[model samples]
Target: MMQQSTIIIILLSLFFLTGCWDEQLLKDVALINSQAIDYDSENDTVKLTIALVSGNSNEKVPTNTTIVSAEGKSIRDGRTELDKKVGSELFASKNQVTMFSRKLAEKDIYAALDGNYRSPLSALTARLAVIEGEAEPILHAETENKPLISDYLRDLLISAEDTGAIPSVNLQNTLTTLYDDGQDIVMPRLKTVEQKAGAKLIGTALFSDRRMTGELNSEESIILLLLANSKKGAHRMTRKVQTDEVDPLYDYVTVDVENMKRKLRVKKNELGNFEVQIDLVLKMNANEYPGDDLYKRHVIKRLNTQLSEELTKEANIVLTKIKEANCDYLAIGRQVNAFYYSDWQNIKWKDVYPTIEMKANVDVEIIYHGIIN
Candidate 1:
């Protein structure tokens, strides 16, 4: 009994004393906050740029920064070359953003991204975006009065989320959607604009089969938000309506819109065609209603009908644009897969998708008169 107790005590002490075998200290590791990748098709080489964070506390003292660029035939080889250029081990655990040139995304971003996903040090939650021009120029742009470039990129994504124009796609989400059969992927397309001091969020990149097939402009992106039911917070919608007792010109009402919700449904017809039904419910506050004492119930009814018609027209226009782009921003296939699994499997979605019919029914309900009837 004494011998066994002594042995058990010795094992516990050994276990407690044994620290992490492969511990990496913060001082020893160079933290990468952002990475940009550019592919040169002409030379069949890839260039990678890593942005390292300089933990300098003194505001007056200028901070020292370094950019390491490497080229190789493959992404892994390029990364190895970058490691050699940096002299220190390239740690990506602190990486917050990954950017790819449009040319690279147009070719295929899977292999380049695969290496990041496979590495244990790389963060799966890093935000992903596509640079409009060369990756290196955007990566090494001069930072004048802003925070770190990585933090700025992160803020750009968060601001886009607030606008409801583009949905955030992190590294993990991008890969999962790229691999999923029922759905496709999309990423925010960023470009350095002359308007907002330096950079701006232009639009979004539409992906099909892990390759960028098309792009959605700001208006088209808003339409995508409405169709996907991803819009949140306040959105501005304007419509012109004529009053019931209208004499033509002087009876127009221009309203500022708020509180919008959209519900979508997918169903298969008897003729083996997919039909999408969209029900849009929205409320409007009266901003500019012409004429004195125009609170008649029938006037409100007529205005609602007119608003509904206009909303339907706008919705169809946006849907048509998405269809033309060959991008399923609404995830119609996902709905079909969830509801009609057998039909989805038997049908070639790519072929059937373009031919799918969409019917949008918009209902505008007036809940408030903005403290004035």
Candidate 2:
């Protein structure tokens, strides 16, 4: 009798745990894949746009996505307006991307993101970006091959980050940096092109205290990514070989950055000025040198030195911009806080960063010269 009762209990437990107990049916739910927020300064209102997935998941690809927008006093109020427009209740658990227009981002990013922060269903890791203009058009933009706009944008962002063209930023990273006293956030920049025919990734937008302070072009962004010692796949660049331009056979050489290591240090000099030094050790492959003699050690050494100098120059430019913006995206303040907490308490980082002495040192090695010499 005890064995029979044990078997019945086991069967009941299995039955209760078998399927989803409170799962909402797909037909009753609106799964959001992307969201965009814009602010209207004239009327003091917020605009919220969401891209919602539709159709059966049993099919290979989703059939379509519908974009809906609404305006209200705040994001929550705007969301309520959106709910009234769409028949199904909206959910952002599957959101893959979130974007804010420059106007909205500049005004107050934290205010715009308050709903997401408070909501449990919000996607904390959704890739975040800043759009050049109104963000609604980007979600509505049609594609020739790829049907889903969110998937296309997410893939493009991932590809750009992997190629070291941009720094990866998501909702979680943004919030973390915004809360941290030492670091700032950098987000990918997007722009609509040709009457919303498509979208283009312009560069990267740097934020200081949740406000858009500066931007880095694609080239500058790569240098910043390298300075940050971001791990990525091989990044390629073409540089003039210092060869005579008149009859140059190999005027330009292509270098692939296989790996890079960066070290940053903060210290006080004898003169009582704070100093920061950044050193980058880079392993590179000469993919296209054109010259047959590039395999020679001396030629390789010269190329390495030249590349190092060029990279250092670019790194300096990045540092200059970082200083100009007064945005410590490099986390130099963290070093100060850890080592010199008393000094940090007295000195204002924003004021000192502009005057601080910072230098970039790059060490490059040409690990390979391709298969054919």
Candidate 3:
């Protein structure tokens, strides 16, 4: 009797099963590959630019992109204007990259991104960047050799993140860090190159809370990421160890970090002040060293000492920049709070962060060399 009733219930439930009610068809709406926000000082309004990806389906490269723009007071308002200009096109589930102009980023980046955070449909996974100039021009950048501006820029940023040249970040984590007192955020910086025919991932933009506090070039950015232990893949760097060498090529050495061990400590010392010490021990494989005397013990030992000093000096420079900007990408504040709550509560972090004594030491060891070496 129970089996018969179960069978009847299963058969009756199938009758009420309905199809997908929220399914959106591809042909009806355009997919946004990239979106850029710029401050229009003349109009005192925000300009929104989106690269709608529409091209040959068979080709791998994003060859064709339809550029669209709208101006309004805010991101959602701008999107509303964009909707009226192009019917049924406020969707951004497929968005890959989001860019903000340096002017806007310096002013109030949080305001520009507020709408996207509130909306559940926003592209949380999209890569974020700060543009050197108007972000829209990068979207309008035309090139014959590359894919669509959106695709090209996205790939460039992803590759940079992989190499630890830029921070791996998105809109999602940015929101969390913006409100956190412990740490600040960093985003990749982008700019047009070669007369607007192409673009380049320049470096990174340092942020305190919501506004961009400072900028770091490519090398400085890489070193910051390394010190923070935020590197994703192989950290390969070429530095001029032999500065006085006659040949430029012979002056430099290229090494790939095989393994890295980093230690960061935040302690309140006898002086009643906080101090941070970062130590990095890196094991590297030499990819290129024109002098090529790795077999000798003294040569390897000397090179090891040279690379360590060079990296430590470079790290100090970058750390000074970070401290000057008051950008706490290392989350030292969090460590202090977690470990020493009394000290954290006594001091206002914003005032103390810049004044804190911080030091970085990097030691590099070349474990192996390429065949030529």
List of clashing residue pairs for candidate 3: none
**Number of the top-ranking candidate, with TM-score as the measure:** 3
Q: Please list the Cα RMSD from the true structure of every candidate, rounded to 1 decimal place.
A: 5.1, 2.6, 2.5
lDDT of 1 by residue, 231-297 (tens): 4634444445644554654556655447777888888789978898899887776666655354778
Candidate 2: where are CA atoms >4 Å away? Answer: 7-23, 56-60, 243-250
| Per-model TM-score versus the true fold | 0.81, 0.91, 0.93
Ranking by TM-score: 3, 2, 1
Error of 1 at 200 (Å): 0.6
When sorted by lDDT, best at the front, the candidate numbers are 3, 2, 1
Per-residue CA lDDT of model 3 for 1-373, tens digit only, reads 9999999999999999998987778768877789999998878899999988776778765568889999998888899889887766567887889999999999999999898888777889899999998899888787775557777888888988787678788888888999999999988998898677788878889988788999899888878888998648776788877764577778888988888999998887899888899999999998888877988888889889999999999999988998898899999889988998987888889899999899999999999997764
Ranking 1 against 3 by lDDT, winner:
3
Whole-model lDDT per candidate: 0.76, 0.85, 0.87
